[model samples]
Target: MRQLPKLSFWQIWNISFGFLGVQFGFALQNANASRILSNLGADLHHLPLFWLAAPIMGLIVQPIVGHVSDRTWNRLGRRLPYILGGALVSMLAMFMMPNASMVVAWMAPVLFGAIIFALMDGSFNVTFQPFRALVADMLPDEQRNVGYSIQSFLINAGAVIGSILPYVLTNMMGVSNEAPDGQVPQSVIWSFYIGGAILIISVLVTVFKTKEYPPAEFNEYKNISEAEQQEKQSFWVTLRSMPKTMVQLAVVQFFAWFALYLMWVYTTPAVAQHFWHTPVGDAGSAQYNEAGNWVGIIFGAYSLFAALFSIAMPWLAKQWGRKTVYALALLAGCLGFVSMYFLTNPNHLIVSMIGIGIAWAAILSMPFAILSSALPAKKMGIYMGIFNFTIAGPQIISGLLGGTILKTFFDGQAIYILIVAGVSMLLGAIAVYFVDDIHAKSH
Candidate 1:
């Protein structure tokens, strides 16, 4: 195969375009899944159980997909095929999730949607890790910051649109807000359908338009021979002997993701109870859906900041160093989470999201940038997959424990969840100082 020229700005934009759709799907789901579950008659205490699909899928699918992508070299290239396949699955799952309450009597439809959600989420992560690695493989170091920033922008932008879709459908389209005691609102159903179509189209753009680097170039890890590919240590062996960096990163990731999971899960409830002063089943009231939409608006604000900060981070790292910049970002998130406790008006919530958004941008980009430099190139996919365990594992822990805290300590109120999340973010910031980024400028 002939050597392809480096991608232009537009090329990078096109390749990264799918995430816009992916985030749209994910943002809508993440911001509202718990709300949807509650509307379907799930207890507040059991909400965490229903939200378990994401971390579970990430834990199981990422490494396997990473390993497969490492060895894959086909007509569609290494990562695009996985991307395409995942997009299709996620779209179908998105469509099903909103309609889950339609299940017949005696069968838990929410549970059914949760299962399909697991499948979709798992498939998406399988494709996601490889896609991140592909960026590392394709871009030179200088351009990586730009590449990732564009991605962050798309992620937040997509989420903003997704989160607001339900509000648009319900308020503007005259959708039914009430659905007896066991069904979902028509607005949410419309959001999922719209999200599904957008998801498929965005992913297909990359599948059809972008070309990938040849496999031989990707496999030249430490200048080692691919001839002894089998002679090299097996994945199980590598799994047994993980690098120290991955181990430490995992420790930090546990706390970081835990905090984030809490924020996403509880933001709506916290806003509804604390800010809006409303309950889930309040009729003829827009408070719940309005609070939900405000969460989207708040999330979008953070994402807007995150996209801007993603650009500044690389430069900031060049000056004060990665550790310091990351530390500051975490501190900002901590402050943001803490501020939620003091928020009286709904509009004031935007102030908190700005800090969380800074942390969000860094968490998404800096960790990958740090890991890519330290990991073995030939095993990039597998290690990246393994690296994802840090992200997924904490989420699982949070899913289990966050519920316990909410029920036992706070009487199922969501404010306490944000408090725990704030502490977790602060703890994660402390851990960042210890991470050794080789490419990061010396202080």
Candidate 2:
């Protein structure tokens, strides 16, 4: 086995640049999926049920893509094939998601939108899970933090653009925010159209620019023994022998993803009810649409903060260690979620977003930085795929229980959902304290 060479900054950048577009599409989805679903006749409580498609698809798709890509080798490259394929499908999904009313008339728009949501997220998981392994595949141990932080930066930067595109179209270009009954707005539609284009182009850049090593060389660089390569490893076998770091990190990931799922599904309705004063089930109203666009603005603001915060992650990890930095970052986000309860002004939401963004930066980079060092190189993809279980599993639980929790415990006040999400994040922060980073840095 040989030590892998340190990747140049541009090489690292090209490898991760596609994530910008991936997150861009995701940002648009996060900001507007609920709005689109509600416009198509989904109730507030039903939002979680409809949102279930994302994690369900991730739970099903990521591990399969990871396991397959691990064994695959072709001219298109192992990860790039999946990356390109997923991006193409995601682009098409994005193009059609906002236009659900016109996608098919036989099915209701809400149902159609959920289907698109699943397709988009499924494709995203396919691309996303591989990129994590690719970093471990390409970089030496020392460069892992820098590599994943750059990924975090691109992810958030794309998110900023994606989140605010609709707002920019509506306010800057004078496009309509409000649509005809049961239809998506022109501004939102165009945002998806533009986001789709960016998604494919950015992925193409990564596909062409980044060169994956061939099997002989990769096996040598990664120290994959011939015997290990020849052995057929089932997903369950991989799961059972998974690293201790993976299991420890799963506890942290579960709470973090569960909290995020709550926020993504509930934030729009929460804003509308708490500040915009729109009546329940009035997703079609002008004020409700305005609130939806505002959701975009604030979501973009958080992405902006996350981008800036990601720039400092490597340095932070160096000074404080990955686990400590991760815990502190989640703590910031937990406090941010708690702050949302007292936010009377829509503008003040940006303050809360800053904390959330700080948390987002760590969530994107640190765990992977920690976990990648601990995973076996040959099974990196499959292990990374299995890791999605932690991320997807909790969100699945959140989706199943969130609506009922909202209706049963909170009596339909969406703001309380954010508060509950805060508690979940706080738990994540505490859970982080328990994880052992195998290659941890310290003061």
Candidate 3:
């Protein structure tokens, strides 16, 4: 059996740089999508349902992209093709997403936003799943942790820039943050345009700069026969034979993602109501838009912290064990969410974000680091894609149930949603204790 070669630090960085752009698209969505939906007159109760499109699209698209990328090989390389194609689609979606309310006067904004959200998310998943497999493809086991942490670092770095774009456009550049009734803000519009352009350029850099091993060479590295490589395995067969660690990690992923989904769907409204005293029905109010931009700043803070903290994750894992570090990170995130209930000032939210940032860094790197060691190299793409189901499935369930839970139990107060997220994150922390960390054990 031939061993895969270790990648240089620069080579690992080149392979991971495309994630910077993919995440720019995601950060823009995460920071602004709910604000956009609310601006278009979406009721708070139905907001989660509108957000549902993202996870649903991700659940369906990632596994298919993974399966196809596994079989695919071309001059642009196996993963770059999907990366570039998805970048193009995401760029288009970003440009159109903020304009959703204006595209059709008769179509409801909520419905239009849902369609655009799905497109952006679908494209992101197509691009994202390949990147996960790329790390496994290019790096040996000893370096996989470093490769994934670098990817996480770049992901959060891009998110920081993307999350802050609107705020910078509004506050720094003096662009108008408030739009007329039923219209999107100029600051948000420009942010999306800039984010889209950056998304393309960053992905193109990875496409042209990074090289992939040829299929024959890749097969040799993985120790798979040409006949075995040629034969397609059914998804079910591969899924049924999944390692125990994958199943255990899935439980952790479920509650963690469920907590995150609540934060993403409710944070805008919660902040607007709690900090700015903006009413839920008054989407077009200047105070409401100001609160939305503040959410962007808070998102940027957390992302910036995540980028800085991710650099230390490999070292932290070595010292504390991956499972323990991950569990502690989730506990910190729980406190972050719970802290939101007590903050009266918007700027003070940064303290809460510090905790969330630690968790975000862990969430991005730890699972992939552990999972990569357990998965077969030949089936890396499919397994990575399957792992996304754990992410998207919980999000889908949260989207379906969140609005109802808010309306029935919380009396439509978004603040209570954050409390629920805090509790869910605490449960996730406990669940992570059960995951078998093969990498940690081996070390």
Per-model TM-score, in order, reads 0.93, 0.98, 0.98
Worst 10 residues of 3 by lDDT: 278-287
- Can you tell me which runs of candidate 2 are displaced by over 4 Å? none
Candidate 1, 1-443: lDDT as tens digits: 23224568888787788888888898888877877777666677777777777998898898888888877889999888888888888898888887877774656876776776687677668657766877776766656666776777777778778877776667778876555555667777888889989988998887787787766665452354656465567778988876776776776687789999998888888888888888633422467767776776787778777877876876787788777877889889999999999888888888988899999988887777777777766787889888888998889888898778887888767877898898999999999878877766532
| Sliding window of 10 residues with minimal summed lDDT for model 2 | 434-443
lDDT of each: 0.78, 0.91, 0.90
lDDT tens digits by residue: candidate 2, 117-188: 999989999889888888889999999999999999999999999999999998889998888888989998
- Ranking 1 against 3 by lDDT, winner: 3
RMSD of each: 2.7, 1.1, 1.2
User: Which window of ten consecutive residues has the lowest lDDT sum in model 1?
Assistant: 279-288
Can you tell me which runs of candidate 3 are displaced by over 4 Å?
Answer: none
- Residue-wise C-alpha lDDT for candidate 3, range 291-335, written one tens digit per residue: 888888899899998998899888888788888889999999999
lDDT of 1: 0.78
Q: Which stretches of candidate 1 lie above 4 Å from their native place? A: 1-6, 172-176, 220-222, 279-286
